[model samples]
Target: MATSIESHVVDITTCAICLEKLNIPKYLPCLHTFCESCLRTYITAIFEKEHKQSIECPVCRTTVTISKEVNTPDEWAKVLPLNFLIVGLLEKEKLRDHKTMHGEELKLFCADHHTPCCSMCVSIHHRRCAKVLSIEDAAMEYAKSDEVKYLKTHLANVDYDVKVIIKDRSSAKENIDKDYKRKQRDLEVIFSDLVAKINDLKVRREAELLKIYNEVKETIDTTLIFFQNKQKNIENEKQIIDAAVNMASNVQVMIEVEKLKKQVEEHKQVIQSKTKEIVNYELLLQDVENITKLAEQMEKACQISCKKPNTYIALSSVTVTPNVSEIFSCCRFGQHTCSWGVKGAKQDAICVSLSKEIELYGLLSYVCKDALATCDVTATVKDDTTDLVVVKDTIDSKVAENNTVKIMFPKPVKLLANKKYHVVVVMKGTSWCYAGGDGETVVDSNGVVFTFNNSPLSNNGTNTNAEQIPGFVFKISDEL
Candidate 1:
């Protein structure tokens, strides 16, 4: 029976074409197996000779169609299904051979190399190592060492510090983008106003030029008509004198000449009186010269200058209540929303303490909405030391946009400095959501230091350690 089993295993493991153990055995639709290299060679030969889209199975002579995804003969064998059963058998055979040749399991730990090894491996490679321990002993020693604890603490601190740095960089980038857009808008307005003024000036100048040209033309036309009338009168007087000379005697001609002489004297007096009006006339215009000067002046009219920004410039000022002042505020860039509550536990709270004495009137929280639905959120401030709910108020979630709504308390409560307080926020219908910047951020504003804590407080005064600290601004009626 053992002989028969050995022969059966050999038949399945060996490739029929190569008559050797399969290296990457692949099977055709006919269930015939061959080595990957042997199959590729056969397929390439058939393709080169026949140039057909199908090939005959080597053992069963069954036709197998090539898929369109198989582009070349070299890829034909790769597209065939792998014989996982044969592969598993081969792996088992390899593992059996490994155990027979190597003679043991990896039960020793080489402390010098920090790796596991068998007896043969230790004798062959780790003979010169200073120390070696059994696996059990090594595990116990590692568990008791302080290295693990120190590493955990160090990694946590480093992660938090890196997150803090990332938050700062993200905020700086957001500020730069906002400032760029603002400056661009300001520049556009300035240029637009300048263009409007230039257009108005152009219209007025053209109208003035036309008015001056019409006045000059009218004066020239009137002067031409006056001179032509005077010439006609002089010619008529000379003609009358000539007619009298031709028709009458010498005495009559003398009388006519005497009468014409008086008229000629009157004509001379009229010409002398009009000599100034009959002088040469020229039209001169200053339109071109004035336009050129204006063009030159406009080039330097609006000067653009830039300098380093000494401080952060907000895009718009937020309108707060009359007497309320903000004490703490977190950045709102890289905006994110954290689930303030999960299933079963629908109430969560963020705890913080102030370093200054003031009358706490209200608080502003940046919230998120799943849809445009009306939802009411209740915020209650509880004193940690006294275990008393100091103040409570409710605000509609629809009004919360970038700290737009101040959820005010019914009455202002005065808390002592250096006291811990928590604001528990509750909402209906779904998990309460709050917006955060960079997931975690720390800020120092208004003489108070605000630190981000990943662990939020539950209703029962226990650390949930699930959600990030919500973004909020503490409002006080008086300045710190």
Candidate 2:
């Protein structure tokens, strides 16, 4: 008995709305596959009518929505064998039609030439053209050839090069990371050094400030104690005077009053001395305070944003110069001569007048051979001049005969404001024959030499003379 042949059941996955086998199926989180378009349209309908825009999966009730752009059939062809299915369907249809006409052979033809061509000729003549061919011919002649094998090998080489490039890029990234770490370490070292220097400077400046403060405080405290003691003594003496005034008629009171007066005088002297000491201490304290304040200001001025090692050292190296006044003066003395008397004794006498004037505050140091030297040196606000001082003396040395002697002064004194002073030297003597006749006796010249601080002055061969002396005029001010 010929039974009816049962057809093979094909399981088809499809979208419900389109009733077409799904070419590009998007699987939702709910585990349902639908055509990308059907999912999008279903979600749009839900959005328009319902307040809730989310759509539920068809198969499962889980909420899911389509992506904005649907994946096309071409994209789906990437992962699935959809193109192979189409080719297989077309092949089956051709075979069925060929079987119906039994007398004529079914000939495979190249679609491009529209004529029957052998499989080898089809592949060689129409290769890479957009033309269709019988499935049997395509499979037998083109797919089985060495050309296909070569293409596969080329693809493999291309993949290998891609992997090499990726490895090299990774190596480069690692090198960059190492270099960054090294630079970070160097910066950290520099930061640490800067911090250390800042701390050192803070400590040094703090010590200096404390030292100055302590010294000034000690002086002020001592002065306060001294003044307190003096005040107590003055009060006790005043009480004695008051008690004596009440007992005037008594003889003992009279004697006590006299003794009290003496005591008062002594107390006055003590008070004066204490007052002077206090004033002096006060002045010294003020000077110390000023210095301390200046140091504070300097610390502020020298503060810097960045810490550097040499900053404090350089600041401390600066030198300060004080204001100074200079003055000079000069004076001259007479000459001397030697003679022989009739008794074969040597006689020597000198007549000398020494005169010198110096600028105010000038200091002088002088030396002479005989007592017969006379000299006067004076200094004034406006000028430095010399006047004569009497001299009677004799110098015995022949080399010293009529030779000059000089008074030398180093580092000329600062001129006092609006003041004048004199430096005088006197000498008197006779020649070797003191009680005898006198011959020609020359007077030795006496002179004064002066120099200003940092000024040019020289001593010539003669002791009585110098090259130059500096002089100055000054006026005192209330501010000084």
Give the least accurate 10-residue stretch of model 1, judged by summed lDDT: 310-319
Best by TM-score: 1
Candidate 1 C-alpha lDDT tens digits along 437-476:
4443345556655543322555522232334224444543
C-alpha TM-score for every candidate: 0.31, 0.23
State each model's CA lDDT, in order.
Answer: 0.52, 0.34
Q: How would you encode candidate 2's per-residue C-alpha lDDT over 278-361 as one tens digit per residue?
A: 211111111222322354433343221211111000001111111222222223222223221122222212111122333222
For candidate 1, list the clashing residue pairs, or say none.
none
Model 2: how far residue 261 lies from native, Å: 99
